[model samples]
Target: MATADPSNSSSAFAQLTNILLAKGGYESDEAWKFVEDLFKNIDGKVLSSSSSVYKSVADGEMVVGLSYEDPCVTLEKDGAPVNVVYPSEGTVYLPANAGIIKNAKHMDNAKKFIDYLQSQDCQDNLGLTTTNRPVLKDVQIGDIMKPISEIKTLKEDSEYVIAHKDDIVDHYKEIYTSISSEK
Candidate 1:
């Protein structure tokens, strides 16, 4: 029952739909219908963060998580009684992006910084500090972190996600909020 701010691009529904679409490749329409059912099923169960979801689990407020991998890793490192499940149904991959501003006064510097973020050292440092997987190939994951290669992932289309994120967010607002309002 872990949730994000509906407007949080990090927790966009596009990835969910992309994942479900992968899972239901032969019947994408049904995949979308199932996603709607999923949101309804999860309506009242939403928790604000991975920690909140972990607290809910600890307090017996919920039985499972539908959240990111980071908190579970953090909790496990702290030795709280919890486990992370990379769903057998397959997980989703959505990378955080770093972009340079258009027409910036220091375009080269901006470009340099973005490039550094993509570099092996910076990415590995990011993994160590944040306990999330680094994008650079074969960087070791933190001990509690799930090795990225092991998870059967639904690789989302960056182009499509970039193009249609707003629509997806709006659709989430429409359906999920409508459920809450009705209830």
Candidate 2:
């Protein structure tokens, strides 16, 4: 297991929730409620950084049951062999999506921009630099992202969970207030 500092409340809870939502397909509002409930049950303060969480865990500063991701974790970073867990409970997978704005003045340019982004060269660059899983079938990006074989993708026919965008944002605002009041 990777390590994190429990006292480092900078990014722990938020990053955990973000990753969980990405894997669980929770709508933003549902995600907010889930996180709120999660924090309400935990004793420690939530930090904003995973690095802090990792350190805290590593140093035995805190204990939590969660998983994390970092593309840079490799033998070079002295990272231990850890498998990315896919809970039987379920997860959400957010593919890198791109689209042109309907009313943009540079419609043609926007199309070209999207095309460029999806090109093999750009995909390779993104794979090399980030955790982005390329959608293009032809792009042979290796070493930069988890191999396609290793990924546990959501079923193509799975039902989508849509969150009320406005409600999600507003709920998070209240959750933040609740968190602050507890301090």
Candidate 3:
């Protein structure tokens, strides 16, 4: 198993617990306990994703990676022998949003691209072609891609990020160092 510091890695499960804790009104100690268990037993690399965590996994430098579903799907599609698994205890779904830059050099092109992405055709085909879960009604995803509604997602706590960002960062560092030190 491999783990990466959550601050710099989108794949890291740093805020994974917030979903569960958020509904309980930011009960962080419990959340920390849950998060700590994820890394407490890892026996692989403690590195940043900056060094290409996916590539390392492909090269067999790591046996398992705690990551979001997209890259894993892409890697497998590109011929890397890997499997995707959800945490047995359930996991969080962190949605990444996108926006067009106002100062982009190709403003018109950006607008067009965004518009195209929002189109019916794109929405209908999104699930099959991309890792993103489509927002449109009645779109079908692959059997491997579980429905978000069926997923056990931690409820989002709006204030948790603002209030606990530092604490979360510290805990992430502590977990990584503690695990790495064991090696």
Q: Across residues 60-109, which tens digit of lDDT does each residue of candidate 3 receive?
A: 98887666677777777677877766655456555546688779999999
Query: For candidate 1, what is the lDDT?
Result: 0.66
Candidate with best lDDT? 1
Model 2 misplaced stretches (Cα beyond 4 Å)? 1-91, 142-144, 155-160, 164-183
Q: Which sections of candidate 3 miss by over 4 Å?
A: 13-26, 43-45, 100-115, 142-144, 178-183
- Candidate 1 lDDT by residue in tens digits, 1-183: 555444553543433655455668323666656666877877744555445656676556677655566666777688767788776767776777778778999999999998998888888888777867787887755667778778888766677656776776676666677778877
Which residue pairs show backbone clashes in model 1?
Answer: none
Give the range where candidate 2 is weakest over 10 consecutive residues by summed lDDT: 156-165
Tens-place lDDT digits, model 2, residues 77-123: 34533334444544334455889888999998999999999888998
Ranking by lDDT: 1, 3, 2
Candidate 3 local distance difference test against the native = 0.64
Question: What lDDT does candidate 3 reach at residue 27?
Answer: 48
- What RMSD, rounded to one decimal, does every model reach? 3.8, 6.9, 3.9
- Candidate lDDT scores, in order, read 0.66, 0.51, 0.64
Candidate 3 matches the true fold with a TM-score of: 0.70
